[model samples]
Target: MPRTERPRAPARAWFTGPGFAPAPDPAADPAGPRLVCFGYAGGTPSVFRDWADGVGPGVTVVPVLLPGRGLRSEEAPYTEMAELARDATEALVAAGHAAPGARHVFFGHSMGALLAYEVACALRDRGLSGPRHLFVSGSRAPHLYGGPDGQDLGDDALRQLVRDLGALRPDDRVGSAYLERRLPVLRADLALCARYRWRPRRPLGCPMTAFSADRDPIALPAQVEAWRAYTAASLLHRRVRGGHFFLHGPARLPLLRELRAELTRTAEEREPSWTH
Candidate 1:
């Protein structure tokens, strides 16, 4: 006999504040792990638009939308790392993303890696639930984050730096009016990085995974490995191919697969086993 399709689970309605874009239907797996992703400087939630499918149905993908971009474009962008972290923490809490017993994880790239770490600290300070695992990609550990100081560079110089970092392709360089409009936001983000200062704090309790790209000059493998200092739990460092923005290319699939496996393992460990 032909089998009948099972009924779909009802979606859980959750608040997604200004700091985040809504996740896909939570009903897909209401109790599954949630993967909160933060993108690089001048990046938007759209960068992770296809991530839900990448991570599979067992995990919900939530991409953060920082102010001064996307729908929040009219709002002033934050220029201080601490302030952004505090506000991001509050936004996550308000949306139930940081509720006690919630199973969630975090993934961030470059500037976003720093932001994600700060947010995790903020949550812990408030006595809230932190991520099950913290994934940082293409960034130096917080204490060692000195920079090229692009915030003060002239528009031409700043654009050149972005190009040098492979953030801007050669073909997209000529006559791109959109790039000109985004420079301010990019500068503001750089200012956040330049002005950041890491203070001594207790190491976080969650395990961490640091992903470094072989060709990424800014965040070398050694710098990525330094993330071990921030977490008391185990640190797994994975090296992949491509440049700083490796997540945007061929490397992204394998990265997502690793994330899916990790998230699934964490969820299984959290579940209570039944004794026969």
Candidate 2:
């Protein structure tokens, strides 16, 4: 009989188990903060690959690969908010190592924003370090989404939903194929988003940056302002000149710049005269 070998683990799944993974720590950074970047709906971690480059040399960008997509395709997508937050918090704790002495930030767009915020609460609940800063883009406050009660819109209506937000086309051949294969995961994620219910808890102690597009139908000014109620720390609002998926191309530069500045400011506040 021939010998059988164990299957190899994928690259992205590295250090994603129980203990915190020892990546770079932001609090130790004399330059800036460590940042974990989250993606939009039906999207994966590849979205922020170039963020560190664009954000300049001070920040370190870590893209989160949600299960059921990217290298974790074999894993099942989470459908409930509690489960999703728990799973994400575990991986983030394992990956970021933002404990003991590290300070960190969360930068999430659309669905990713909600996931990051919830994970912060879950981290606090688990007696772990929560994100010190949160940058939410293209999403309203958690309570505004309410529930998935109206999620059963027609296909045409759904197309309009995507179009209205000007997201990446899920129909463009290769893109469509990827989306088709990944639709189950995406739908599960959307379901999680739909079912999420917000509890009126105490505000987050971290500073928050609410960023959005000037033309985004999904994010109104009022919706963006609701983010202010979630944090006792400084809350800043900045508007860009694009649609919901603005972070995909050159438009991402400004967003990255702002992130770098914030992280730099945070690092400076924690440890002054590092530049001197």
Candidate 3:
């Protein structure tokens, strides 16, 4: 899909479609980077909806609402990683072209981080220009070794994992509706996670920044560090307070500040190559 293609919108797109809504002049914000922030399996664009404003101008954060959530409620969530990546790449191209000249970035958390990484590489393979920086939060490296088999996870096991990871609990009072909607999405997301198999490949050339929690059980430092094997891009990792979803926690300010600095550096590095 082109940047101008309408995203399968949940609501009758007042603007046209998901990715093309409120199209901006990608050229005007040459330094004004266009971010396609993906969410964890069950997550939504609302997670980083204000990320652009918070990160400051010159950077426009566009949280990607994967199908089955937000406005595209009718669509089913993508199961295959490559398939999701293709859809994401198309959406990104749409975002970039619809916006022109806007530098691009891919940001994802957990499963989303994985999605972002895969999509970034896919864009690279397709010879399409991609983000200046790859900001991955709360995830393990693709090449990192070891883990229990996540694929055989039954609903009993799946639900336990979610709650154990503190993502959700069906029994937890309140937010049941929220939990009801998100948990299935999370389960489907985990299915992708469990089935994902990484083969040895060349590392991505873009600079990579990873965010982790001091208490993150799913992604430990070693796993996070393993990301180095897959990235020719300089790898930097930051550990903050919070279990899994630290991005929403208090550490966001310092985190956002660092993100701003890196994004600025990346844009400047690419600036000289620009014709306009």
Best TM-score among the predictions, by candidate number: 1
Error of 2 at 20 (Å): 15
| Candidate 1 RMSD to the real structure | 10.8
Which candidate tops lDDT?
Answer: 1
TM-score (all chains, Cα) for each model: 0.86, 0.81, 0.81
Q: Report how far residue 124 has shifted in candidate 2, in Å.
A: 1.9
TM-score of 2: 0.81
Kindly give the number of clashing pairs for every candidate.
Answer: 0, 1, 9
lDDT of 1 at 186: 92
Q: Clashes in model 3: which pairs?
A: 3-94, 7-18, 10-71, 26-99, 26-100, 27-100, 29-32, 32-58, 104-131
Candidate 2 lDDT trough over 10 residues, lowest sum: 14-23
RMSD of 2: 7.0
Q: Each candidate: what lDDT?
A: 0.79, 0.70, 0.67
Clashing pairs in 2: 21-94
Summarize candidate 1's per-residue lDDT along 200-272 as a digit string, tens digits.
9999998888999999988999999999999987788899999988887788988999888777774455333
Model 2, 46: alpha-carbon shift in Å? 1.1
Ordered list by lDDT, greatest first: 1, 2, 3
